[model samples]
Target: MSSSRGGVQPLMRAAELEKMSLEQLKAVKEQADIEVNLLQDSLNNIRTATGRLEVASTALHDLSLRPQGKKMLVPLTASLYVPGTLDDADNVLVDIGTGYFVEKTMAEGKDYCDRKINLLKSNFDQLIEVASKKKTVADEAGAILQAKLKQLSPSS
Candidate 1:
């Protein structure tokens, strides 16, 4: 049967919903319960990840500002052709495998810096939109679940 409003079925009242067959009502209750639990878990995960992202952003800022000796700073300077540049030059090491200038182990520092920037942007967007939506869904699901539970136990 076609519904009148926006080609969709009208929402039912809590009292009206309790009149459905046991099997149909049971399925709806199960779905609502699952949605509530899933939304709660997702919110927890997003919170934890957001905290980590903040820490990572702070660390990246510190690293970017921190002074570095010759060797630790070479990876950030993209100009490979600059010869006899004395700034932080003593720390440069010749790679045994490739005979090219390589910063010992601090190369990963650049990677981490890039990762931190991207993560902050992406996660912030997700937390604002997806996480917020999930929270709304969980709230609605919680209401549906509560109504179903009360239907099953009318006196409570």
Candidate 2:
């Protein structure tokens, strides 16, 4: 919500809300819609991250059971696969982010994958929590819009 003087306020008391014009009410509704959309986007991102983490965890488990120097078709993309053979089975490349890589033992790589999964799960949970709160705010804004519209209705 914004005050008459143009500064934005996060929440408006009931009395302050009484001062809002129809245009301001509409603007508030718009802002709430925007917030909901942004939250939805964040939720989608969390879903994607969670899915990738699940796949990583599974891949790590499968790798731990494979024989050393096992031949496998490595995925380059959704449709592309390249013939590849594992090296030591004891040594693996771990990505630390930003295209950087580090060498680690297989056990260490698996542990790293587990830690990454846990961190992503924690983050995903937080996003869901925040999205739930924003949903409540969006619902309230919708109710406010409805009330304001009723007050301005011809039957009012």
The candidate that wins on TM-score is 2
Query: Candidate 2 lDDT, tens digit per residue, 33-141?
Result: 6766776787787678667767866876787788977999888777999999876667777778799999988788878878877887787788677556555555655
TM-score of 2: 0.78
Provide the clash count, candidate 1.
1
Write the residue-wise lDDT of candidate 1 on 40-80 in tens digits. 57657756755665654464455545554323432434345
Cα lDDT computed for each candidate against the true fold: 0.48, 0.70
Worst 10 residues of 2 by lDDT: 5-14
Question: Using lDDT as the measure, which candidate wins?
Answer: 2
Error of 1 at 21 (Å): 2.2
In model 2, where do residues sit more than 4 Å from their true spots?
1-19
Give the lDDT of residue 39 in candidate 1.
48
Q: Estimate each model's TM-score.
A: 0.40, 0.78
